[model samples]
Target: MSEKKTINDAVSKRYEHGFVSDVAADTFAPGLNEDVIRRLSAVKNEPEFMLNWRLKAYRKWCTMKMKTWASLNIEPIDYQAISYYSAPKTQDGPKSLDEVDPELLRTYDRLGIPLYEQKMLAGVAVDAVFDSVSIATTFKDKLKEAGVIFCSFSEALQEHPELVEKYMGTVIPVGDNFFACLNSAVFTDGSFVYVPRGVKCPMELSTYFRINAANTGQFERTLIIAEPGASVSYLEGCTAPMRDENQLHAAVVELVALPDSNIKYSTVQNWYPGDENGKGGIYNFVTKRAVAHERAKVSWTQIETGSAITWKYPSVTLRGDDSVGEFYSVALTSNCQQADTGTKMIHLGKRTKSTIISKGISAMKGQNNYRGRVKVGPMAEGARNYTQCDSLLLSDTCGAHTFPYVDVANATAKVEHEASTSKIADEQLFYLGQRGIREEEAVSLVVNGFCREVFDQLPMEFAVEAQKLLEISLEDSIG
Candidate 1:
């Protein structure tokens, strides 16, 4: 076989988590309005403050238009045609795995979730979300005993409304942007965490989202708070079943680090990408931001390799003197997928520091773009910022683009930026081919080396998974 054919054969694997559950679902009718917002809030039984906030966000979203500043060419979406909420027929949260539906449990097993009581990882707590509602939050008692508050957003609103109301939109305000506004207006379920002062989270906190019901938009909202002198690490993963019709997902995540605290967040997004021809998949638009108080720190690490169209920019704002922020990302798109992903850093306090490292891999006819921004305000004297963006192409037909914006108003501040774009060279492939190395293996070696810098920042569990995903995504494309 030719080298291209050999490479093609390796990359043509199907989406492994694309099997749907047959259980009946309760889904809200497709549409959006003030009434819909009111109904959703009522269903969640949120406090009055939350309802008023949602109304304000909805009103603002009504007057705004879809953001087209991105280099992506997205199809028109009918907001009224998307179901706002969908959940398994169960009317309440699962109190335990025994209370979960058999179908849902089976789905979890198929997706490789560690839900078994006996197999549970001792140090990790997970909040599992199916469709638009959280199904279960594991290790609640353990977390509570340690004075750590971890639960679903719904549970947080009902049990700790004060905390929810105080930190929910503090990092990314209600009127932040177009997608964020939509998420604030109709977000149904997500994860919430609060690390008390002077304590490090006993274990890693995590959330897994699975999209089941067809034609339903998954609008999840996540908020995390680390009080002064506290530290916590959080992980988020997501996947969806295969479908012929495209689905919309707009989510918002906010993080707040009080003085002398640290918060580290990581994501492994494997949302179902449409078929090779881009026939069906999810349009993932998300906004994630964090703020660091005096002498605090925040970090974000992500591995994105799925979704037909993915738009996300995880950002950090250094608002306190000597605070620190860091972002490390690896985004890969294959088989007609489109991804525009990166991060932003805002320096507003004296001596604040930030670092960014991004890697993009494009295969088949996919298009990948790295867009980032760094700003140093007038008062941010002695601030320091560094950025690195790199792109790798597996096919001649693929494209990679970069756009970096740096604004410095203080002469005392210093900023450095660097970018590189390269493709798999024929000579390199030939040398490998001559050395008895197969095409697929050669590609994997080259790609992995290119991504080693970013992968080094990922948690051990996700690093292996990301490498496997990269192999699968590029297997057939280079052929």
Candidate 2:
């Protein structure tokens, strides 16, 4: 085959995490009602207060409407037609890896996540959430030894009900928005973390979400709390099986950093993004936010290269004096994907500061947009914010956009915003090509360089994975 043919073949490769595992699952019937909420809560054996909270959120969702985002064209969703919950068939939660289903373990192994403690990555604790339940959590004993509670959301609710009740909806209220509200009512499973005062977590806590069963919407809720003088770094990864019909993944994440604490959250989302025709893939609508107290810091770094439609704004609220917030993102859209993702910084305390760096890459028929907001409250004297949004396009058929919103209530507050849109330069490509670099590899090199700034914020291992995902996503955009 010719060189161009080989490149074309590489570009048209199928989604790697697209195969479904053959495992028996107990799935709810397709529909939503108060009864469904009650059943879901009961299935997890949740506390009575949790049931009441879900009911309240469900009632609010009944009166709410689906929101429409600017410049995003999404098809109407039938909420009633989606199964609210699905889980691998089990009598009770697995107590150990041996008790877990073999097929599920193999499934995770295939995805490059080993749940076995001895086989998994060292210095990392993982809570593996498959479908609607957490199947395994590694390094639990070690985390408990250091007063760090890292486990599935369901486990947290059972083992630490007081902590869960105290901070569950404090940051992201039950009725935050349409998707988040929906998640509040029907969310099945996710990860939860709590670091005690004056203690820093010894290992990186992680959660890997896998959407397996068909016709089931994965609504997971994650909450992380760091006490005074505590610090932790958390990472999240997600994947889904490919099908002919679109699936919905609406998740809510809340983080709280107390005085002098620090929390860094990273995500490498590689959900199935359908074929060139946009027939399948995932509709990812997620809400992630963090609140930093006095002298605390919260950072968000995400590498998004999947999902047919991605709509999420990971935000931070600097609520105490001298708090800091940062957002670094690299979102890539390829083969008819559409992404409307960015971050929000709300400075509510004196002398608080924030930084936002967003890089958007569009290839083939992808449409990428960065919509961000920076707000400074009246009490935030001497607050500062800096935002930079840059977009890279690989083909003329794709488009990139930026919409930034800034509101400053204090004259002492200072904010700066910079944005640019550019395409792969022919001269640069020619230079790389003259050195015997193939067209596709040259394009990948340029894309990786453009995204290095954001990648630098990720963990060492994840940064390399992010680069490979970007290269694979840019396939077929070049001739």
Candidate 3:
């Protein structure tokens, strides 16, 4: 097929690669039973204590019901029909990219993350996760030199259970939310990083996740803990091939920053978005939170462009005196995509401060919402918050909304909020076209400029990729 024909066909089909893999999978019989949980734990060779923890979470999830407050209209999920565990049929994960499956490498290359791995392997440390397992983690020896513990969550569970046990679920508890409870129950794999006291990581730590199988949910749990005086920057990228059946991707990420430490978490989510008609796409329901302990800091930056249905709120709790929290986000939804995302900041420490900047872009019947909250506790004297939410409507068929909630308990706290919604001005586009830029390029340039604040917050590697993603997502939004 011609390239244009292929693009048109992909748009018509909704899911680009929804085909099932031929590899035999170790799957649990369609259902969410205790036996299924036990078998999954056994397959992972998890310790008995972890099994008990899973059981507790499973029981809690069973009693909970689906939430209906959000503006999402999702189909009822049949937990029984999903394959809880599916991995490429390999006896042991490849030690290097050379030994890894060629098909997997091709997928990453297509998604623009292979170069990221190549750069990381050349002295930069990366923990790359394909489907449910960590494929290759480069520069382990070098990272170890600085006393940084960077490895898969499963590996950390086995090698450094003491650290895992001490901080697991500390930031986001087991019963935090419905999706978090489910993730706590069935999370197969994810990354774990622990920067020891006073040691700054030599390089950026990153995880590239790809979901390749059908009816297989991607429930990964990420936990990062920076001890006293330590600092680290972590990046997470996600992609999935096209599929007809809606896939559930429920993940939980918990970050903890101890005294005098700082943690920066960045995410660029490009999951498979169903076609123009919204046939099949991933239901990305994720819960991510961080706790800034005494005099610590945490910042969250995200660029969301894909996923047919996305519901996420990355939040931070300023629990220590003189701590800081920040959130910068750009959420783009086009062609029937729906996203209700933002952040929450809870100020409990004295002199705590938070800044929120959110940009929402909607086009072609898409719906986007920025729902956020800022809370100042009674004891949080001299707390301050600044919030800004702006929306860009690419077409008349799309919709954008913002809901900001603020509760101030301390009289001395200072808070400010500003929001605006605007459409792409025809005059602006015409002026750019007169300046010799093509219509598409003009639109992309304007959209990029609109999202520069959030893009600048991402790491250098991801900032460029995020810009490219925005260009692709806004291709048809222009005249």
Candidate topping lDDT = 2
What is the clash count for each candidate, in the order shown?
5, 0, 4
TM-score of each: 0.96, 0.97, 0.93
> Which residue pairs overlap in candidate 1's backbone?
4-479, 8-476, 11-475, 11-476, 274-280
Off by more than 4 A, model 2:
1-13, 473-479
RMSD to the true structure for each prediction, in A, is: 1.9, 2.1, 3.6
Residue 443 lDDT, candidate 1, scale 0-100: 71
lDDT of 3 by residue, 309-336 (tens): 9999999999999899999999988878
TM-score of model number 2: 0.97
Query: Quick one: ranking by lDDT, best first?
Result: 2, 1, 3
Per-model CA lDDT versus the true structure: 0.89, 0.91, 0.83
Q: Evaluated with TM-score, which candidate comes out highest?
A: 2
CA deviation > 4 Å runs, candidate 1 = 431-436, 473-479
Residue-by-residue lDDT tens digits, candidate 2, 1-479: 33434333443456899999999999999999999999999999999989999999999989999888657889899999999999999878799999999999999999999999998777889999999999999999999999999999999889999999999999999999999999999999999999999999998889999999999999999999999999999999999999989999999999999999999999999999989998899999999999999999999999998899999999999999999999999998878899999999999999999999999988778899999999999999999999999998877678999999999999999999999998878777789989998767776788789998999999876778778776644455445
Error of 1 at 350 (Å): 1.5
lDDT of 1 by residue, 1-479 (tens): 66555544555567889998997888899999999999999988999999999999999999989889898879899999998988888757677878888888788888888776567666788899999999878888889988999999999999999999888888898888999999999999999999999989988898999999988999999999999999999999899999999999899999999999999999999999999888899999999999999999999998888899999999999999999999998888888899998888999999999999999988878899999999999999999999999998777778899999999999999999999998878788789889998777887777788889877877666678778876744434552
- Which window of 10 residues has the lowest lDDT sum in candidate 1? 470-479
The CA lDDT at 474 in model 1 is 44
